[model samples]
Target chain A: MLAIFKREMRAYFTSPVGYMFCAIFYAVSGFLFMLNTVQAGESANYASYFSILLFLFIVIIPLLTMKLVSEERKMKTDQLIMTAPVTLFDIVMGKYLAALTMFGSAFLSSSILYYIPLAIYGKPNAGLYIGCVIGVFLVGSAFISIGIFISSLTENQFISAFGTIGAIIFLLFVSALNSFINNEAIRNFLNGLSITTRYTYFSNGILRYDSLLYFISLSAVFLFFTVRVFERRRWSKS
Target chain B: MIKVEHLTKQYGDRYAVNDISFEVKKGEIVGFLGPNGAGKSTTMNILTGYLSSTSGKAMVDGLDILEHPLAVKKKVGFLPETPPLYLEMTVKEYLNFIYDLKKCTLNRKEHILEVCKVVKIEDTMNRMIKNLSKGYRQRVGIAGAIIGNPEVIIFDEPTNGLDPKQIIDIRNLIRELGKERTIILSTHILSEVKAVCDRILIINEGKIVADELTENIEGALRGNRRLAIRIEGPSSSVLSSIKKIAGVIYADISVEHEDGSATFIVESKNNVDLRKPIFYMLAKNSWPILSLEFTGANLEDIFISVVDEADAEATVGKK
Candidate 1:
């Protein structure tokens, strides 16, 4: 498992995917921090910055994961990996953790760098800032897992990327679609189901165990599905 | 070291590998010979644990593949038709990754260098795999497979798409590797097995149509020794002399050369070395022997007839 993890980490930087992810992340996050906080005369406004970054995660996080499994299948490298002494869990988890570390590193480093200016120019709320970072990282984890899972289903990278987009949008926008419904019970249910609704608890500097469990379990369920995809393929007629 | 029993793999309603059984003892070089879509790759995949057999068992080194998958995988090295390479990585990184992935206990740098030398890819170790030609890439793939020095190695079309020189090089490499390890390689080319294998299994339409030692394939069907020889002497005298030899079934001029030389197709009794007697007779007559060859006898015809027979049976079964 460690071997696969290290290879994937090296692959990210060996190719352009790693640098591209960090670049897009820094540029957009810096711009968001400037527009919503620096330009708006709000010195320590992390809530708006992180919220926008969460929205951006829908696009860029998939970039980090689009080729993870699909490229292996396309190049037929899966034969080498699958035939090795490693188990299927090791394969899926190695790729999953490598992608998590990439997204987390970029997200964490940028969060800290942007926080530095806030500390100098204005008194930043350290507790609130920490809460938002933690919340965003968990959300990014969920998105990355979804991307990896979709990547497992097909050999075409474009299909994996677009399928991730469609799945994430439906999960994130469940709350937005709730306003059209007249029943309060259905609205509450959508609120409970929305990934964004639970995230609001963390972004507001309130730690909710249920929300944390939701994100962790969500990631596990998708990763479980990815491993099952491989297992089922062994029995597949093709 | 490898055994497969009643292994059947069905793809949809069609059986890709249908109740095929075979065994390979230690240090034997077995060749899986068949045409395209003849279940060669499917059988190799099942043996290497890349795919599960629909309803059969494959064992390598006394361990059942499905029951002890990781153990079986550890003992068998596989090189599929296309070398599964990370084109983005330098050969060095790829080798290191495989070494670690296989949980190899050998000294890391030294073992990798040794594998490179074995496959004759020493120069391409530092270069990215994508930059290398197809031949070099294949060498690197082979190096990766043999890294841990597994007791058994299986290759599917190891020489496919290679030039003649590269084909001969890989064949020589396989022959060398076969000396110490049990090896199974699949190919559609007949001469390849004749050149490198000790035993041959000819599969067709998901079944073994013929299985024989490489040396016996000709005699196994024809029950005689056939030789095509070119002689510089007159055609009439050479034909008469060859027919006069002991155990000579028949001798006839197959081709008449413009320079008074002729080629004769000689059929002799089985277990007879007619070349020695033919050589002595020509030496006594002072006629020089130009060229003498087995001509593959009836191996090609045998392969065709066997596969055709299997196809006919399948057609009849369908009706």
Candidate 2:
């Protein structure tokens, strides 16, 4: 599993995908920080900053994970992994952790740079900022798992990326539109299904352990699905 | 070292591998001969634990593949039809990944170097796999397969894209590997089987049509003895006299010369020798015998006839 993780991490750098993801992320987040907080003359506006970043994630997370499993299938390298002594769980987890590590490092370093200006210009609430950062990281982790799962379903990278983006968009918008529904029961059910609804607990400077557990559990569900996809292929391949 | 019993893999309604059973002892190299979609790859996939069979079981070293997949996979090294390689990594990096994935307990650095030397890919260790030639990439694949030094190795079309020189080199390498490991190689190239394999298994439409020692393949196909003769005599009378022999079943004239000479291929019942009687009768008839040679089916002939026979049986069964 360590071997797979190391190779996958190196692969992200050897190809242009890693650098492209980092560039897009930092550039967009830096712009959002300057426009929404610095130009507005409001200090410690981490909530709005994180919310916009969550929207940006719908596109960027897919970029990070589009080629993870899809490229392996396309290149037929899955044969080596499947025939090896390792279990399917090991393979899925190794790839998932590598993508998670990449996203976390990029998000952490850029957010740190953004924080320096907030510190100099005005007072920033340390607790709220930290909570929001962790929230966004958890959300990003969940999104990456979803992208990895979608990638396992197809061999084409573009299809995987688009499919993941579609799924994320649906999840993000459903929560925002939940209040417009007339029926209370239907609205509450959609609220429960919405990933952004759980994320709101962190952006509001409220650390809900249930929400944290929710994100972690979501990630496990998707990774498990990815492993099952591979397992089904073994029986169905003609 | 490997045994399969009544293994069947069904793709929807059709059986891709239909009730196939075979065994391979240690230190033996078996060649799987088949055209495309003949379940050669499917059977290899099951043995390597890359796919599951609908029913029946495959065992490697007394461990069933389905029940003990990881253990069975650890014992067998498989090179699929295409060498499963990551193009972004260098040759050394890819093999190192395989080493760790296999969970090898041997000294890593030394084992890798020994495998590279065995496959003759030591020079390209630092070069990325994307930059290497197809032949070199194949060598890297072979290097990966032989990394853990598993007791059983399965190769699917090991020499598909190689040049003539590379093909001969790989054949020699497989022969060398066969000295210690039980090997199964699948290819449609008959000469490759003739050169490297000890036994041959011919598969047709997902069924094993012929399975025997490579040396006996031709003899097994030719159930009756055949003799080809050229005679300098009247074509009609010579053929009739040759057919008149007690043991001869059929004699077909193949070629007729302008000078009343003819060539005939004679089939004798069982393995009996009809040469002495034909010689004596020809001498009595004043027909001079130009040439007489005993002949049996070659590998190509055996392959075609066996597959054709299977097709004929299937059609008759359909009726």
Local accuracy by lDDT, each model: 0.91, 0.91
Model 1 reaches what TM-score against the true structure? 0.91
CA-based DockQ, model 2: 0.73
lDDT of 2 by residue, B239-307 (tens): 887877898888999888787788899998656889899999999989899999976577788788899
lDDT of 1 at B144: 87
Q: After superposition, how far is residue A106 of candidate 1 from its true place, in Å?
A: 1.3
DockQ for each numbered candidate: 0.77, 0.73
lDDT of 2 by residue, A1-238 (tens): 8988998999999999999999998889999988889777634376898998999988799998999999999999999999999999999999999999999999999888888988887788878888899999999999999999999999999999999999899888887786588889999989998988898889888999999999999999999999999999999945
- Maximum-TM-score candidate: 2
Question: What value does the lDDT take at residue A97 in candidate 2?
Answer: 94
Lowest lDDT 10-mer window, candidate 1 chain A? A37-46
In order of the candidates, what TM-score does chain B achieve? Answer: 0.85, 0.88
- Model 1, B35-100: lDDT tens per residue? 899999999999988889999889998899999999999998999989999999999999999999
Cα-based lDDT at residue B49, candidate 1: 84
lDDT of 2 at A171: 82
